[model samples]
Target chain A: DVKVTQSSRYLVKRTGEKVFLECVQDMDHENMFWYRQDPGLGLRLIYFSYDVKMKEKGDIPEGYSVSREKKERFSLILESASTNQTSMYLCASLNRDTTEAFFGQGTRLTVV
Target chain B: AQRVTQPEKLLSVFKGAPVELKCNYSYSGSPELFWYVQYSRQRLQLLLRHISRESIKGFTADLNKGETSFHLKKPFAQEEDSAMYYCALSGSGYGQNFVFGPGTRLSVLP
Candidate 1:
């Protein structure tokens, strides 16, 4: 089965602290994405990487950045964590040839 | 730019009833659409994609190009079908990023 592994299931961060959310996919997919899920806002894309060393900003990339130094791994970074950034973070990978996309078990982040 | 929209946020129905989840998209090029489901405590997974034209778990979606809509339907809903459903769309590009709808949570009452 296809697997997208997230580095953490739950995390708590302090204000102004730099944070990293890591994801690794075993499917050798070419596209990786980071999104934040909220109750009413749904899943808003934060960033996406099309290939190693190539990244694009999604609609909601104001407070977040991403890194994809390798094909199988993608990382989301919060330069300075804030209370509003606390939410469920999800990572997903897409097969370049198909329409199917696989998602990781989300990481619930809490910033105090 | 591509966007997916799910109109209903919540839907509750008794077992054995028919169910329909609406989805619409706005994109300039040909759209690749998919329906993803997330069960409680489970990771979000693809339930079906419009390109395959196949049904899974008795659920099927028909893509309407003129309407720019892809709606998921199940003739007889089951208790196990209750889950969060998301509609996603991809534009015409290699490794295109998907735009997802806000999702609809289905509740099947026993």
Candidate 2:
């Protein structure tokens, strides 16, 4: 089965601390995305990478950065953790050949 | 600009009732539409796509280019069908930038 694995299912961080959310896909998809799922906002794109070392800012890219150093791994970085940043983060990978996107289990981050 | 809209935020239905989750999109070019579902405690997954023209879990969606809508429908809803549904649109370049709607929460009460 195709899988997109996230490094953490839950995380807690202190204010002003640096936070990293890792996502890895075994399917070797060229496009990977990071989205924040909120109550009413649904999924808001944070960042996305179509190729290694190439990234694009999504609708809500402020206070966040992304790294795609390798083909299988994509990391989302929070410059400074704040209460407002606490939300459910979802990782997804999609192959250019198809429109289907595989998603990770998601990581619920709490900034305290 | 590509945008998706799900008019209803919440819809409630009893068992064996018909259910329809509306989805509308605004895109200049030919848009690839999709319906994604998320069950309780489960990750979000694709429920159906417009291109496939197949039914899944008793749900199906039709892409209406004229109306600019792709709505999900099920004739008889089951209790297990309760979940969150999101409408998405993919532009050119093979879904490099996917836009999702606000999502509609379906509550199928037994």
Report lDDT per candidate: 0.93, 0.93
lDDT of 1 at B83: 97
| Number of the top-ranking candidate, with DockQ as the measure | 1
Report the lDDT tens digits of candidate 2 across residue range A5-106.
999999999999999999999997889999999988889999999989999988999999999999999999999999999999999998677789889999
Q: Among all windows of ten consecutive residues in candidate 1 chain B, which has the lowest summed lDDT?
A: B89-98
Candidate 2 Cα lDDT to native: 0.93
What does the lDDT read for residue B68 in candidate 1?
A: 95
lDDT by residue (tens digit), candidate 2, B36-104: 999999989999999999999999999999999999999999999999999998787743698899999
Backbone Cα, N, C clashes tallied per candidate? 0, 0
The weakest ten consecutive residues by lDDT in model 2 chain B span B90-99
Error of 2 at A2 (Å): 6.0
TM-score of chain A of each: 0.97, 0.97
DockQ for each numbered candidate: 0.78, 0.70
The alpha-carbon deviation from the true structure for residue B39 of candidate 2, after best TM-score superposition, in angstroms, is 0.4
lDDT of 1 by residue, A19-89 (tens): 99999999988899999999867899999999999999998999899999999999999999999999999
